[model samples]
Target: MRATLIEVAPRDGFQPIAPFIPTNEKVAFVEAAHAAGLRRIEIGSFVNPKAVPQLRDTAEVLRRTAGLEGLDAQVLVPNARGVALALEAGARHIAYVVSASEAHNRSNVRRDVASSIAEYGEIVSGLPAGVRLRLNLATSFDCPFDGRMAEGLVLSRLEALLAHHEDVEVGLCDTTGRADPDHVFSLASACLARFGEWTRWVFHGHDTYGLGLANVAAAWRAGITAFDAAFGGLGGCPFAPGATGNVATEDVAWMFARMGVNTGVDLDALVRLAARAASLPGAAPGGRVRAALLGACATT
Candidate 1:
């Protein structure tokens, strides 16, 4: 089966940067991702403008790219209010993040695990039917403040969320880049065993330790087909210390191509897009493929 790679750079990558990417530039970024054959792209978050000024123009950005062909626009929502705003802005796919680590969850959203779950439940109940919900279990592999996560604890959180909302899809996120291939497979296997054929899980990893691709491969073997990657490896958890950018979209595309799995992304076009992102202030291409492609083009 073909895999899905969701491009989260316009939201996740630009969130931690100091300066706001102009709204037009943000739209251009989305257009580039769409042109490169990415069907799903996270345009921005619908949170407090003061909290994350970079994404304040999410509505405008979404408005600009709303009617693109074969494009699915996703936006992150922190609460019911955010979800309301996202829907008002015509967002069809919405994502919510809750950390598996209690300390990290409290730090990220100012809510304890139980409280966040309750709030998320309320948010889900209030959503209008037909809106796709994506729940990210952040800090799934390890917590910067809490160290490694117990597999049982992760499974328990998953069970708790599923209990409240059975229709939701979940993403296992390595929020602090602490996941290795072995640990990733073990946790994925545990989740698979307990959930038994619930395939709506996505692997979201950061490359802080340079093990992003390895962990991705492990998850793929564990039967995960959906992934969250950023252009140029440009993302980090603003609340999670020591976190780095996500696995580069182009890099993953290259790896999957070699492995005979199709991602439907144009590797060469993605490299060009990454190069455009690297030109923006406070941005840099952290993935290897863009550099490699540049070198190859230079020699040719």
Candidate 2:
């Protein structure tokens, strides 16, 4: 089976660190991701620099990456204003995040459920032609503030969002790393049932409790071919405190390669880039299988 892994190492992974990474390093990260066969990447966000200090250089990063052939540059926009900035910076793809939990959503965007939906609609209305918008429904798995929310709630929320726009891709985020394989399969089945076939659903898994790979496999089995993973397992939700980084691109690459699954990613190259991110101040290097296989631990 073929799966597309949108590497979030540069954006999501690097967003919550200290000694802010320079723009050059961010550029290098995107370049290395491309070298590793990652054609889609969330490079940065267009929020207030004070809100997310890590992405203050977003415009410069997107500008430097706009000219890269064959690589799709996507940036996160919190609202219509940020969307405009992304288009000006040459980002052909933009993503907006909304959480299932009202508490998490409010904390992240200061908007309650209905208002968040309105904002999502407003953002959708202002998109430019050819610019893909991905609406990430965070906490599709579990919310840190609410805890173990039912699939019905998540499905209902997703349906409501899809009711606003039919063409946009929906991201099912396993925020707080609370997904099990069974959980993913059931939730994905519900999504397919509610949203129908035309809507694209991408699974975004976190590794807080280390079932990320299994959950990815489950979702893939449940008809989720598009997924979001981070290079070197970098990034956590800034609003979801204590949540871990995303599943590693290298780790996912390794998992899929052996399964005869084509992720179009080079595992070794991702490992190198991950090492670079890990070396940065306050960056955490994750992906156990990646570290073991590529580092001193791989016996093979």
Candidate 3:
């Protein structure tokens, strides 16, 4: 069987860094990811500059990387205004995020969960032709502020969001990186069993507790084909205290390759790109495969 890996280092990985990455550098990374065999990438986000100055040039990055052949350049957006900005910048794929936990939702987006869901409906209703929508349900498994999310609560929230539009893709996010493999498997299994036909499901996880890859494996066992990972595991939610970087793209690719699953990612080239990402100024990059691969290369 094959799995689809979506590279999100440019947006999710870069968003937490305090220093600004040049627009050209961001675009260049997106281009390099494409060359490295990543067909889908979350390149940047459209949010208030004051809140996330690191991604202030997302629009420009979108415009610059728009022509990469076969690249599905996706951008993260928070609300209707963000969707508008992304659309204006020529973004056809937009990911709108809303935390499932009420407290985390307020902290992340300054709104309640219901409000965000309402806005999602509004965004879907006004979406133009040729545009694609992806809903990222942050804190789906665990939240820094709310602790582990209940399975029932998650299912209810997912139902509400999917009711807005079933054609969209949905991602279950472990925003705080605190989910266990059992918890991940349980929730993922439940979700797939209940809503498998409504929309496509993607798993987004972090490596903070060292269970990132384990959770990914569990999700895959539950039939989740698509996943979101960052090169060098560079990412964290600014609002989710104690949260860390995502599961490393190279790690996921390596695991899948060993499992005889076709991920279509070139691990050697991905490691090279990850090394560059790890060395970024003020970036908190995590992951073990990059170092392991480098050591192997040096000893050889």
What lDDT score belongs to each candidate, Candidate 1 first?
Answer: 0.89, 0.85, 0.93
In angstroms, the error of model 2 at 146 is: 0.6
Question: TM per model?
Answer: 0.97, 0.96, 0.99
Query: Distance (Å) between predicted and true CA of 232, model 1?
Result: 0.6
lDDT of each residue in 132-207, candidate 3, tens digit only: 8999999999989779899999999999999889877899999999998899899989988887486899999999
Scored by lDDT, model 3 comes in at: 0.93
Alpha-carbon shift of residue 297 in model 2 (angstroms): 7.6
In candidate 1, residue 127 scores what lDDT? 78
In angstroms, the error of model 2 at 173 is: 0.3
Candidate 3's displacement at residue 257, Å, is 0.2
**How many residue pairs clash in all the candidates, one count each?**
0, 2, 0
User: For residues 134-169, could you state the per-residue lDDT of candidate 2 as single tens digits?
Assistant: 998988888889998788888788778888788878
Model 1 per-residue lDDT at 105 = 87
Ranking of predictions according to lDDT:
3, 1, 2
> How many residue pairs clash in model 2?
2
